[model samples]
Target: MGHDTVETPNLSFGRGATPDRSTPYARYVRLDELHSLQHPRSKEPAELSFIVTTQVMELLFDLLRHEWTIARQALREDDLPAALAALRRGTHAQDVLVDSWDLLATMTPQEFNSFRSLFGEASGFQSAAFLHLEFLLGNKNAALLAMYDGMPGTQAGLTEALRAPSLYDEALALLARRGLLPPQEASEQRYRPSEEVAAAWRRVYTEPESATLRPLGEALLDVAERVTRWRQRHLSAVKRTMGGKPGSGGSSGLTWLRKSAEQDVFPELWTIRDGL
Candidate 1:
């Protein structure tokens, strides 16, 4: 399976808009255009931090999605080394994403309130890039497409991601090829934990004969752990800034975030722990 990197059609950064290529630093990274993107809505100093942190997260989301796409394709081809390398790169990026919350973690409620109303109805929940990252992690929700009905191109790309087999799907399929058949189609199931799947993993951990699968299992667990940590930190940051207030774009704020943090990404890998 050939992999293609997702294109950011909305950004004007790299489409022949960059300066002369003679100076590698400015041209190669589009530093001038990147710095020009920050336009804070309010006069409050805290708003600048909010805008920059959110934009940073969007960039990290794209980076992680790119790595996961490669990992998914590599797994489909049964290329273990390739898949592991991509997964390793994604985990490193994930750690940076998880830490990005620190930039906004210290914002006092007064400081946040000072600028919160300036950007009315805008929400991080509407980020297409974050949604793409979730879809790659096997957390597909078709209903999210409605939010982007106004933007057909973005919706189409997300639709492709939602329908396609995710990185976890490929991992489970690889295990099944080696005789650990999961109970259902991994692509369709939404975090459905199967005892059969757990037992298969138990064998991978306990039975030395199944040693080849251990690295993959551990790599997946690493991803799940980092994602959970990210959500937890996000929830904490929200609670610190807004408490139980309603979220922007009509979400339930802390209530919604708490639920997201509790949700497990890779189920059987955790369920097999007691046996191990």
Candidate 2:
């Protein structure tokens, strides 16, 4: 029998080897680099917790985007089962994202302020990863392109995401292919709820031939619901810690988040529920 082998990710940390028994696993996982990235600007007890939670959420945002991209391509190929699987995995990741708020939920306003100023103009609003995930979910905003003008690669990637078909767009294209709606095209503009889309979803719920799309609809709703839950949790956490204070990076904090939380991720899916 022949064995196949593949190269592994470089684990060179320049430490050579250490006495710790877990060095092998730690090196493989790059735990040293991961742990070192958490630098607390303040000696305050809660600052490290804040930084770690933020980093964890950012990493999860990248994971969620990867899964959604796969699902979007799967939908484009009319691979319903593949898309559903990716969406389901995405929802589970979203659930974890929502739960991440637990780490910061108890942070008092004083504790937050202790290190808030240290962060200066930096803000989560500036996370390209989160913005990319938003675009993948069909919440495009061309105005955001200016935010990354200094970073060419980031700007170009965002531009592509802004122009490419989102997961929801591809899902609608799948429905159109089944003759549920007229042909669809990718739109860079933020998705607005359309009566046609709502009616198509309504038919998916009631029509016998549309049975195959039912699970996909339900899976999308799952993803949408988790999105809402995550945003609401973020708002709750921020309000608890900042109390309407202006966010870093010139954002309006609660006002902006409140509007975001109120906007349903899949607007048509939510509206279709009423008639179903």
Model 2: CA > 4 A from native: 1-22
Please give the CA lDDT of all the candidate structures.
0.88, 0.92
lDDT (C-alpha) at residue 181 in model 1: 73
**Candidate 1 overall lDDT versus native:** 0.88
What is the TM-score of each predicted model, taking all chains together?
0.90, 0.92
How would you encode candidate 1's per-residue C-alpha lDDT over 1-276 as one tens digit per residue? 499888754545676796444457877888889999999887889899899999999999999988999999999999999999999999999999999999998999999999888889999999999999888888888888899999999999998988888888888888888887743475633456678878888888988888998999999999999999999999999999999999988999999999999999988899888776
lDDT of 2 at 171: 92
The list of candidate 1 runs beyond 4 A from truth reads 1-22, 182-189
> Which ten residues in a row are the worst by lDDT in model 2?
12-21
lDDT tens string, model 2, 115-164?
Answer: 89998999999999999999998999999899998999999999999999
Per-residue lDDT, model 1, residue 95, is 96
Q: Give the per-residue Cα lDDT of candidate 2 at 211.
A: 91
Top-lDDT structure, candidate number: 2
